[model samples]
Target: MLIDTHCHLDFPDFAAERDDIVARAHAAGVKQMITISTRVRKFPEILAIAEKYPTVFCSVGTHPHNADEELDIPVSELIELARHPRVVAIGEAGLDYFYDNAPREAQAIGLRNHIAAARETGLPLVIHSRSADEDMAAILTEETGKGAFPFLLHCFSSGPELARVGVELGGYVSFSGILTFPKSEELREIARTVPLERMLVETDAPYLAPKPFRGKRNEPAYVAHTAAVLAETVGVSAEEIARITTENAFRIFSKMPRV
Candidate 1:
């Protein structure tokens, strides 16, 4: 079985046929999925999706792109919200200099808040970093030094230094469909070196669809394709790759039941 450790089922892209999407996922051997929240304000929408499907779970955190708007959200509130049975992790949060849609300082402050929430609640932080590796690595390293917190560099396409630092800090690194692209040789190289136990597979769906599906809308069902490529990159059987990643998912999102 496979678990899509990260996805965005709440997005409008899936609105027209959400139930069918989940059905297809289960049919594709994706036993479970986590629908990530990009903003706490819409958490009810995210939660509704998880609540509607027994195999689906969710996280609540502000994406860096909306960090400035959510800066006022309290860490205490994040901790409180995470108390729910289906809330398994925190943040799709981190730096995103590639877009610069939000100020860098605001993004940093927001990331720290999510980190604090993760540290306090023992939930893995779902990090997103792009074009801001140095600051991202430095902040993650610094915050982790204060006290360890479980986290994953979700949909990772960062510099090797940041990947190295995250792994060194006992954090996980997830690969998305981007790894399957012909031009992602460098990313595949990094994937080869990331310890098998710390690796995870995600689609970051409604975004980076895998090879044959590239340029089209992505969904949880497509994660199987990413897993297949990950298996090749990791030098293991497709079944072994699925087993390892699903195991890693349970280890990090300990709140989720093993069934």
Candidate 2:
């Protein structure tokens, strides 16, 4: 069974035909999916999606791109929202200098606060860092010193240096459909270097669809394409890639039930 570790089924892209999309995911061998949260105020919508679908789960926290909007969400509220049985992770949060949609300082503060919530709740934090490796690495290192909390760099597009820092800090790295892009040869090389035990696959669906489907709307079903390409890049069978990555996901998101 395959697990699409990061997806956004809660987004409008799937609103008109979610059941059909989910059915396609099952047909494509995806057994479960996690709907990532981008804003604290929008978490109930995320939760509603998860609760409505047995195979879907949810994460709670703010995305770095929306950092300014959720800046006021307290550590207490994050912890409270995460207590829901369906909320198995915390974040889609981290620094994103690539867009600069939110202030760098605010993004940094949001990341640290999410880490604190993760430390408190023991839920793995789903991080998204882009073009801010130095600050991202520094914050992860500092947060680890305060208290170790589980986390993973979701849809990782950062440099190899940060990938090494992530593994060194005892975090996992999840590659999304972006890995299948022709220009992503370097990212594929980085994927090959990350230990199999600390690797995962995601669709980041409603975004970044893999090659052949690159320009289209993405969904959990397309995770197979990313996994297949990653397996080829890592010199492993697609089945092996699916097995290990799903296991890695379960290991980091300990709230998941053993299957």
Q: What residue pairs are clashing in model 2?
A: none
State the RMSD for candidate 2: 0.8
**TM-scores of the models, in the order given:** 0.99, 0.98
User: What is the C-alpha lDDT profile of model 1 across 194-257, one tens digit per residue?
Assistant: 9999999998999999999999999999999999999998789999999999999999999998
Show model 2 residue runs off by greater than 4 Å: none
Query: Model 1, clash count?
Result: 0
Highest lDDT: give the candidate number. 1
Tens digit per residue, CA lDDT, model 2, 1-259 = 7899999988888999999999999999999999999999988899999999898999999999999888888999999999999999999899999899999999999999999999999999999999999999999998899889999999999999999999999999999999999999999999988999999999999999998899999999999999999999999999999999988988998997754
- lDDT (0 to 1) per candidate: 0.95, 0.93
Native-to-model Cα distance after best TM-score fit, residue 210 in candidate 2, in Å: 0.3
For model 1, the stretches where C-alpha displacement exceeds 4 angstroms are none
Q: Which candidate is the best by TM-score?
A: 1
TM-score of 1: 0.99
